[model samples]
Target: MSEDENQISIAKIAKKSTPYSFTVNILAKLHRNSYLTTIHEKKSYVLGVKNIWNDHNGNHATLNIIGKAPLTPFNLDSDIFLASSEQIKNSLGLENNPEKAIHLGKIPNVDIIASPNIENFGRLFITGKSGSGKSYTVGVVIEELMKKQVPIVIIDRHGEYSSLKILEKENIPDNEDFFIKNDTEQKYLGGIIEFGDINMNPGADLGIEYLLAANVEDLIRSGSVIIINLRGLDIPVQENIVMTFCNRLYKASTLREIPPHFLFIDEAHLFAGKKKSDTVEILKLSAQEGRKFGHNLVIITQKPQLLDVIIRAQAGTWIIHKLTDLNDIKITCNSVEGLGYDADEEIQNLLPGEAIISGDLTPNYPLRVKIRKRYTVHGGAGYNVLDYITEGDTLPKSEIVEKLRRSLSHEILESASQEIISNQNLSISDLYHQIDALRQENQELKQEISDLKTNDKDKSLIPEGEMKEKIIDNLAELNSIPLEKINDKMMNLMEERDDAIINLKDFEKERNDAIFQKQSLELEMSGLKVENEGLKDILSKEKKRADDAVALAERAVAKLKKRK
Candidate 1:
């Protein structure tokens, strides 16, 4: 190779004289820990890859200055060379700058560990496509934190993290009942606090108001791994639960009611999106100022493009996985530091369980990490399709027949039974119980008044008559206003409850109708798929015939040419 081939000036590279491929090759050939010699404002300074970039205007190697860089008079155009180990040390101006780091995983094919600096672990934003192992990586992080005894509260939308209770994946039972019932029936690594029903798995048993009034403190005080499971609930109900939780947490943090802990929110884009909402407002406030109050947020989402701008900007760390969407990639590149347009290709090509770690966590440079395996079983690994193909052998034929009969007979009843047992129902029932007690008391009081009247008319009790009269007057005054008000309020609540029940029933009917239509559509789609295959066969035959005709014409043309 000629010396000139290896002797491209930084100025020429910056001015688009060097091709993009050549520039990439040069950088790739440089030592991993090497520093680039560049001049800014006539002052010589060594910069890292994060501070350098291949210009996007054309094939220029000009750096896209991110945080700090000279605007003009930067003249390090001389031939670029790799900085020695000593030179890199001197450039960084560090002797022994050491701190704690959280060991995440190792770089593929390298012994060097990929652990982020602990002190700068402020807020993390984790994003990836569905099934890209983003949640699995979160499990790995949580397990590490658990070892450190750092409190964690997860806003689990799909109830995937419950598997964290087990020490490791191998402890999972092999019984089908274990999977069916969603039970581990084994010792847990740490205490698991659940606010929702055990039967339902993931949902708010009571309304949002009830949770705020009751469970928020319990959630804050519990040092265990807390999971606010919101699976299987309606979107509005989920929003309400999250809104209430955020509001309480934000307010309490401001008052220093809770200690420093991690709050991992999955599907963060749903709560904090382009549209403004009460939930969004609280989340924004938390992202902006909650760090000061020790309320650290770990926002997780599959869609980075939809996440709030303010919240995205506040994240001190980013764990990006594979993303195919153009907008998602664009937003991720723009949001994260030490990344550029070139990084998009790497992101798109990232394998499952692999991620690019950037930002304050890894300040020196971005780390391409293969996420370590989880200690706990991954509940999010969806059911295998093969499992359904196997025939069931557990039940006798008679038992199976009985079960089928029962299911068929109770189909409508089972649908009704599926309604969530909400706190609203309990509250209405309690109100009625109170009203019934009040009525019984009123009847006893009336009977006593009648006896008192009879005794007063006969003069059998003289002194007691005046006292009885006073008591009667007091009772009348109390019943006259307060009792009437209570009755009116109870009646109003009952009417409202009735209306809500009616609306719920109508919604259920609509849902059932939709399900029926979906079933019908699926059957139609099956038929259409079979028909489509038949059509494809006929088209292939027609294409073969046409090819034969074209071949015959070509031969005929060759014969005519020879004759001429």
Candidate 2:
């Protein structure tokens, strides 16, 4: 075809065939060296000069280029083969190393090789459903990288990677024999692999200074594999430790001139979830900026949808295994390129240990392949209840169990104590109400006593003339009563009335004193109420601490049981 014909616009292509089909067909024929570059609304092709080769007859011919202009579509084949080793080297800007490529696994008929370079650090992501060999694949990559003398740090959420310390043969369970060494022996690559367990129990020492004193950076610089076990830690504590460690590591990397280090976070969604957290923020920053500081992140998680978009976007290499959940599959497909309808079907049908590899680490395509075996032990296997029962083994040490029980007991006691305090507060409130009612009644009684005193005073102030007339009538009716006897009787009655008035005044004074005593008691109760509220606050804090302690202890117990 003429050069002009080769440069037809997308508008013209759509006239002859649908844009989607035409674009796919043209991309299928595009050479590896040719890239679709867009300028304005016109699509142009840039072919590598090196790709122009002379034939054996010394005759040179240009390869056929097919595509429409305006829109340069990417090849949509999900099962495209990877570029050769030399092509990969050139594409990734790496020196050609015949032995650097480690055999990852085989596809339908071809073996797949992956050579992870330092330049592409902090860009690998592996995800799969549980029991689909996610951890196992991580082990394979770690083993290969260790042989390459790359420093690695594993954030082992479930204490799985600790078995990296043991030889493969030693770590195999007694009830199962899965690995068999063949006659063709792989190279025995060794390095300094160490296990460090940070106890995250509530009272455990988690000071950042202690972490610095552990010489974590020195060990990593020496090419050691450090596995940080966070099995029994509370979620908050785990997040804190991971965040602190990453921050420290980032700061350290900035100061020291060290070899590139790889950080592998297994179950990474826990740390870099959609929710905002200190751990998530730190991990996002690390993923974006860690490359310049010689730090790389390899995040592994089963739930890709739960990870933050920014964190997922930073990954340049993605190894996706079988995922049954449609939402998860949709998320994985969206995150990656060259994966669509056919790829979706393939993902669902993928067997355990099989995955589709994509990203900058691979060629401009997705390669479906089975993951290779690990030289190290896979420590994150599911427990078999049958084995424990059939083996007739007793329970392991009960120290963790006992500690958990005690913690729960302590929490319960604190809760009960808080309840009691709450009840006392209620009682104090009721007492205040009662005292207020009593005060109201005392005021009413005082008014009634005042009314009685006024009536008594009015009765005592009756006219003397009327009193004399009444006495004279009584004396007349008797016709023989003496005036002196009458007068004496009137004086006795007046004296008795005055004495009664004095007694009523004394009773009013006593009632006033009783009201004063009640006011004092109410004041004391108010003070006690303030103290109770203070006690409640203190108890709330104590209860929270106890609850956290109990949660950690319970996790420890569960971990112990799983080990047994």
For TM-score, the strongest prediction is 1
lDDT of 2 at 331: 85
For all candidates, the clash counts are 0, 3
- Predicted candidate 1 versus true structure: per-residue lDDT over 33-112, tens digit per residue: 23455434455544444223445453323332222444453432344543344444344322323335466776655344
Give lDDT per model, in order: 0.63, 0.58
- TM-score of every prediction relative to native: 0.53, 0.49
1-564 in candidate 2: lDDT tens per residue? 334433442111111222223222232343423322222224333212112223453322122122222243433321112234344334333324634554456543322344444344447999999988888888878866765667888887766765554346553335422222331222231233322222221111122223323444554664456556665433444566677677778777777655678899987887898877667888999899887788888999988987999999888789998898787898888888655554677788888888877776553446566776665556752212123223554322213223333344444545533432232212354479879999999999999999989967896587878878988999788978776588557645644654564487559856977898799999999999999999999999999999999999999999999999
Candidate 1 — which pairs collide? none
lDDT of 1: 0.63
